[model samples]
Each structure stands twice: as C-alpha cells, then as structure tokens.
Target: MTSTSARVGGIRKEVDAQKLGPALLIASSLVLAIRTARWPATSDEGLANVEWQKEVEHSGHIAKAMLSHLISRYPSLFLLKDVPWYVPTDEDVPE
Candidate 1:
C-alpha cells in the first residue's frame, strides 16, 4: 500500500511540474518584454513610435519558443509515427 501511494505521489509531482512549465514561460515572456521596453532609446533608434515595437516582436519569439518547447516535451500530442493522414473516422462513414 505504501508503494502504491508513493507511486501516485510521484505521478502527481510530475503533472504539477508539467503545468508549471507554461506558467513560467508566460511570466518570463512578460518580464523580457517589460525589460526591453524600459531600455532608453538611442539617437539611432529607428521607428521609435512604431506599434510593432510594443512587445509584438517579443510575443512572436515567445510563441515560437513555447511551440518548440511543447513539441519537444510532448511529442505524443501528435499522431503516431505510422498513422496516415487520410485515416477515416466515424464522421467519414456513410450514415
């Protein structure tokens, strides 16, 4: 019984860690955007007033990083290696 409880506790810790990963990513992205925005503009800073400078670029990078992290960490989120794209479901069958 102790072993079973210990196993379940381990699984719970792993699940909690997985949930924390995305939260950390979002918090870090916000910190990065704020830090970059607070930097003083230089004389050669081009298009200082442009909307794109307002964290949009950082958001794009963050999105890509998040996607890469998720794909690497949870490859099973995709189809099996040998599964065909044209595999039919119940909806595809004639009623």
Candidate 2:
C-alpha cells in the first residue's frame, strides 16, 4: 500500500509538471511575440486609398485593376475574400 501510493503521487507530479511546463512556455512566447513584433504592411492596410487610385485610373471601375495589383504585389497563394476579382463565372466572350 505504501509503494502504490508513492508511485501514484509520482505520476501525478509528473503529469502536473508536464501540463504547467507547456502552459508557461506558451504564455512566455505570447508575451515575447506581442512585445517584439513587427508586422509587415499588407496591401489591404491602405485599401481605401489604393482602391481610390484604381477607381480614378479605371474610371470608377476598379475591380480588375485592384485584383491585378494585388496579385502582382502578394503571393498567388493568398486568398482574398469579398474582392470582386475572384468570383468564378464564364467569360461572356467564348474563346
């Protein structure tokens, strides 16, 4: 009975150590990331101004121009949501 209780206490200590270790690591990392973070400027950061410029160039029809600019600036893998350029539909003129 004494040996069994000692083993159980040891196991509980190990489990608690494991759980608290990871929790502390994650908390410290989050604090470090928040304190020393330098996020790069994305295209959408100044979206309104960019769209306004595109609108002027495209005569208030900025959809295609904005998409082209975005694709050129960012990686093709990025998924932009609610942008007019990405809707899938058949082109009116058949190839």
Candidate 3:
C-alpha cells in the first residue's frame, strides 16, 4: 500500500510540474506580446499597424477592423462558408 501511494504521489507531482512550465511560458509570452503591441517599433509596417489599431480604438470600429484583419490573414477562411457555384435543388437533400 505504501509503495503504491508513493508512486501515485510521484506521478501527480510530475504532472503538476509539467503544467507549471507551460502556464509560465504562456503567461510570459502574452505579457511580452502586449508590451510590444502597446509600444510598437519605428518600422513602417509596425507603425502602420499601431496607427491602425489606434484609429480603430478611437473610432469604436475596433471589432470590425480586427475581424477584417483576421479574415485577410486567412483568405480561405470563408471558402467553406461560400455558396457553391451550382444552385442547390430539392434533389440535393430531399426534405
């Protein structure tokens, strides 16, 4: 009984250790990303993105622009949502 309990405790500790590393890494990365976004560099593209983010924020169009950026980044995102070239008929899926 003692040996089994000890092994189980060790396994639990190992899993907990694994979780801690990933959580720490993700938190640190998010912090760095926010800092970089809040203070963009002098590069033209970086400055442009920063300005766009600012303008969207000020104009209250942030959601629309953010959505557009996401869609543009993945041109094929709406491919699956698009209607087929051929018109659908009752034969396609009988009611």
Who is ahead in lDDT, 1 or 3?
A: 1
Question: Compared with the true structure, what per-residue lDDT tens digits does model 1 show for residues 1-95?
Answer: 11222111121112233445565577557756676786666665565655546565666577667756875798555333332234344555587
What 10-residue stretch in candidate 1 is worst by lDDT? 4-13
* Ranking 1 against 2 by TM-score, winner: 1
Per-model TM-score versus the true fold: 0.30, 0.24, 0.26
Q: How do the residues 1-95 of candidate 3 rate in per-residue lDDT, one tens digit apiece?
A: 11222112121111222233444444445544554576655657544576556654543343344435645675443332322244344455465
lDDT of 2 by residue, 1-95 (tens): 11222112121111222233444444445544554367444567644765445434443233344434545675332343332223223442255
RMSD of 2: 25.1
Q: Candidate 3: where is the Cα deviation over 4 Å?
A: 1-15, 42-95
- Candidate 1 lDDT at 37 equals 88
- Assess candidate 2 and give its lDDT: 0.40
Provide the lowest-lDDT 10-residue window in model 2: 5-14
Candidate 3 lDDT for residue 40:
51
Q: List the residue pairs that clash in candidate 2.
A: none
